[model samples]
Target: MSAPFQDKVCLITGAGSGIGRATAVKMASLGASLSLCDINYDNLSATAKQCASTPRHLDDVDVGSKQEVEKFIKDTIGKLGGIEFVFNCAGVNPTSIPLEETSDEYWDRLMNANLRGVFNITRGVIPHLKRGASIVNVSSISGIRGSAQQAVYCTTKFGLIGFSKCMALELGPKGIRTNVVAPGYIDTPTNAGIVKGGEAVTRMINGNALGRLGTPEEVADVVAFLFGEESRYMNGAVLEIDGGIKMSSTTSSGK
Candidate 1:
């Protein structure tokens, strides 16, 4: 009966699946008006249907394209009136390979999808964000620590952290707070290959202090908190929802 996000307008990228889908559903349930986008139309439609009763507008978009991102922002603002919260969850998980073996094209693809996507969206939305707006960017634990054969992936995520921190500094004075969420070993479709990779995955799961993978919903809960008034004092902070993977040394979850 109580909706914390009532009257709030939220913009979420990558709303087709994983943490992004979960967050969209969460915010909708909390009474937020939503503007969602993802490259996958079918999946994005499914997400929208789940919250069909809520006020929402969605489109298929590639966040890596600056022109596409700008258009999405314009359309979202035009429909929703304005944005109060933003969740940047559009990204790609790369194939693991040595830096030497990683081709220039592949590296650029990863950077563009994982890093530039966030950049494009953030830049497009700054002028439209209302005072006291909140932004949560999805980073990976790889951004905090290195991993094997994930040179390009790590590079993009690490770059995301720096950019988000800078957003916090630049936007905080405007009363818009920006924060980052670094999730480790989440059981999302993006990590389906690693999740089913037999013993390697088992050992990885055991390494987390919780000895389990986190769910998209679990991470969504933290994201909702970050956007809510409860975390008003929190700014430029990175919250890890990795089931203690960051603290455990025995597990190499390939986050």
Candidate 2:
């Protein structure tokens, strides 16, 4: 059987690490050509080098900048002929702080990186997207429900979901599909130090039906599916990959 993504051009933001890095490698392994971007030039170069395909290009882009995102999208179309898949995965989660203590800088940083960044990139790529193309926005389970000290982060994730749904409705008739993958607490180097053994980690694990934190690769798998024809019927969908964490019945209120 032929590879699912053969000859397709995939554009991925945050391709330096975490879910973005995993998705890039996974798509490339399935025969897709890649255009990777991240603020970390060194890590982006590392990802480009690990790809199975030759002639891959890596760009250091601030996805929050409309001009930068538009330029990257145009350049990718110029080099690769067209864009078929877009994985909007750039995001940030600041150290947990109470809502009252969260500074203006903190809120702006999270909103710019997590929400506006997705908007910038997606809008730039919209006109260039090929018929039947797909876009997957990386959201979070926090978007679906509240979490202590995660107000700002959750706001961005929720905004992303709303954006994805609206885009899907607008683009669906034009043959472009848009959806979101909301992953729960996933294990990644970025969070390695912060998620160290603690009551918080224990609470997170026990809250999930699976009793485990998810893996980046697990989230990547759902992303890959959304990019493939197998999920062509799915649009405007917020597919949750949280190991049933959102469905847990436990409540802080003692019954």
Candidate 3:
């Protein structure tokens, strides 16, 4: 058979790094036509370089801004045609701090990027989504459980789950599928410092059933599956790609 994504139009936000970049590369290899955006143009250009030969449009977009998202979506449809897949992978990670120490600035930052950004992109793309389109949102294992020093971050993620579920119900009759992926302790640019620390690494491995941190590519594969025909019947599903961290007693202390 031809590649599963052959000729399909896939839109990925946060495509500058981490899981988003990984997914873009994977989808490109599978023959997807892509529209990729990130707030960082240099990083985004690097990602685009690695996905050479695929039909793609690149734009520097801050998904948190409705205007930026709307413009990018308009440009994408004008360039790549209608969207068949969306990966809402843009978000900010939390800093370890007591709730009292969590500044208003910090709260707003995470809320804007993690929650509101998803809202902007999803809402803007709905009108352009082709029938049977699929959307996979990236949340965190912290979303499903409580974590110390991450109250606001957890709140945004938890809120994201509720929002995605509601969208699934609202868009189901339209033949669109919406889902979430909650990953735990991923090895990404955002967590590079943490993973480099001996104590933090040990804590993360201990909490994970796989005994190691997950890779961005691993999460990307699951996102790709959710967008593929294989997951046709799945909707409103929140899959945990956390190395079984949720089932373990030990948990990362957000250090």
Candidate 4:
């Protein structure tokens, strides 16, 4: 039998690792042509090699650069015919530093990598996106709630939620869908060392109702749903895949 995404063309940013890599692999498994972009060439090539569908291209793009993002989109379209789906998953988390200690450079870096990166990619890809195409922005639980020492990161993510909603309203008329996936702490190479034998890990597990960190694959599942016809009616929505982390307060506070 043919795969659900057979012949579809997908563009994924930050596809070298974590949720981005997982989503790229998942989409490829369903037969979608992939355009993987990341700053890490090695990881991007690794992901491309693992994909079931051949990659149309792998780009080392710094999404914060509008020119680079536009170039990547153009390259993808040139190679894959057209873009049918886009996953804006590139982002960064600030170190656990007090607000006052956070430097201007830190804040700018976080915003540029997270919020501005998404904006750059979206603007570049919108014109080329086919009708019925889907765009999924990867936000975070920090965006939906307060997180210690993550003020800047949280701010960008919260902005992303709003950005995606407004884009959805504008794109919906064009038969394109825009939405967001807010993931909780997920196990990934970037966080693996930090999460190991750390107080932060303990706090993360205890804070979640499930008492565990989420996996990249788990978040990718939600992304796939958003991309497929199963979620055809879903637009301008922020689906939280945080194992009840956001809902925990309501249960514990019990009004």
Candidate 5:
């Protein structure tokens, strides 16, 4: 049988490490050509090297900047021909600051990196997307339920749901499907910084039905699924990859 993504060009932002990297590797394995970007050159190169067998390109661009994203997407098309799928995974986790102490500077920074970054890239790629193309934006479980000290993060994710919904509605006419993937606590460098060990880690593990953190590969699996023709009928969907953390409150409530 032929590979699922053969001849298709995939664009993934924040392709340096974690779920982004995992997705890059997985997609390439499915015979997709790759165009990846990240602010971290080192990590980006690492992902590229792993997908060396496929036609791949790497760029260091800030997704938050419209100009940068535009140039990057255009470059991808110029080199790879056209974009068929986009994984808007470029975003930063929020700083655990109380709402009272959060400053405008900090909020703007995260917003630029998270919500605006998604908007910038997704909007830039609209004109270039092939019909039947799929767009998957990586959202966090916090986006749905809200997290303590993550007011801004939650806000951005909430905004993404609306944004995806709008994209789905508008672009659905053009055969472009837009969806969001809301992953629970996964073992990624970003999360490692905030919940490495001790009470926080234990608390998170305990809160999940599986009683353990998730892996980037696990989340990538769903992303890959969402991009394939198997999910062709799916649009404007926000699929969660958590370990049933949201399914039952008893896990965390200790009831």
Candidate 6:
């Protein structure tokens, strides 16, 4: 049997670690060529080597910058030939502090990395996508619902969903599909402190229906599906990899 993504060209950002690296690993095993980028050359190079035999190009790219994203896309097109699967997986975690204590720098940093980065990358890639292309933007459960201390992070994610929907509407006629994946409390390096084990952590872990944190590979599986023909009919959709955490969220109307 052939790999699901055999011969496809995939572009992934934030390929240094976490969800991005996991997706790159999975896609590489499935016979996809990759154009991967991240700010950290060491980590990105590590991911590149783990790809085994899959053809790929790696660069230290800051997706937050429009100029870098534009060059990255051009280089990808020149190297990979064309991009069929574009995964906007680069983003930063929000500072878990009250809005009152949040400084302007913190807010701008998150916005630049999360929101503007997505915009820059997506804008750069749109012209390269033709018929039968797929675009997946990574969001968070906080975007779908609310969080106590993640007001701005939620804002960027919510904006991503809207941005994806518009892309779907505008580009659907050209045979391009756009979608967003929302994950909840995935076990990544950034969340090491929370997943380390504690009372509050235990509460959050048990709060979800699964009573545990999710893995990056778990989310990558769904992304692979969306990137392939299995989801040919899916567009402008939001798929959550939260293990039922959002479903269990408290709501006055339903309860």
Best by lDDT: 3
Kindly list the per-residue Cα lDDT of model 5 for residues 1-255, writing each as its tens digit.
467999999999999999999999999999999999999999999889899899987899999898999899989999999999999998887667789999999998879988899999988999898788999998777778866777887888888888998999999999999988988877777783334467766766776788887888988889999999999999999998778784433111100
Q: Give the TM-score of candidate 3.
A: 0.95
Judged by whole-model lDDT over C-alpha atoms, candidate 2 comes out at: 0.82
lDDT per model, in order?
A: 0.86, 0.82, 0.87, 0.82, 0.84, 0.82
- Of the two candidates 1 and 6, the one with more favorable TM-score, higher being better, is 1
Q: Write the per-residue lDDT of candidate 4 for residues 1-255, one digit (tens) a residue.
A: 457988889899989988889998889888889999998999888888888446568999999998999889888888888999999998775466779999999998988999999999999998888789999998877678866666777788889999999999999999999999987767776662244447756666676778887888998889999999999999999998867784543111000
Pairs clashing within candidate 5: none
Badly placed stretches (over 4 Å) of model 3 are: 192-196, 246-255
Which candidate would rank higher by TM-score, 2 or 3? 3
Query: Model 1: runs farther than 4 Å from truth?
Result: 192-196, 246-255
Candidate 3: the clashing residue pairs are none
Query: In candidate 2, how many Å is residue 121 off?
Result: 0.6
lDDT of 3 at 14: 93
User: How many angstroms is residue 53 displaced in model 6 relative to the true structure, after the best TM-score fit?
Assistant: 1.1
State TM-scores per candidate.
0.95, 0.92, 0.95, 0.92, 0.94, 0.93
lDDT, candidate 6, 192-247, per-residue tens? 33544476456556657787778899989989989888899999999988767845
How does residue 131 of candidate 3 score in lDDT? 75
Model 1: lDDT of residue 148: 79
Q: What is the lDDT of candidate 1?
A: 0.86
Per-residue accuracy of model 2 over 117-152 as CA lDDT, tens digit each: 999988898888868999999887767776677788
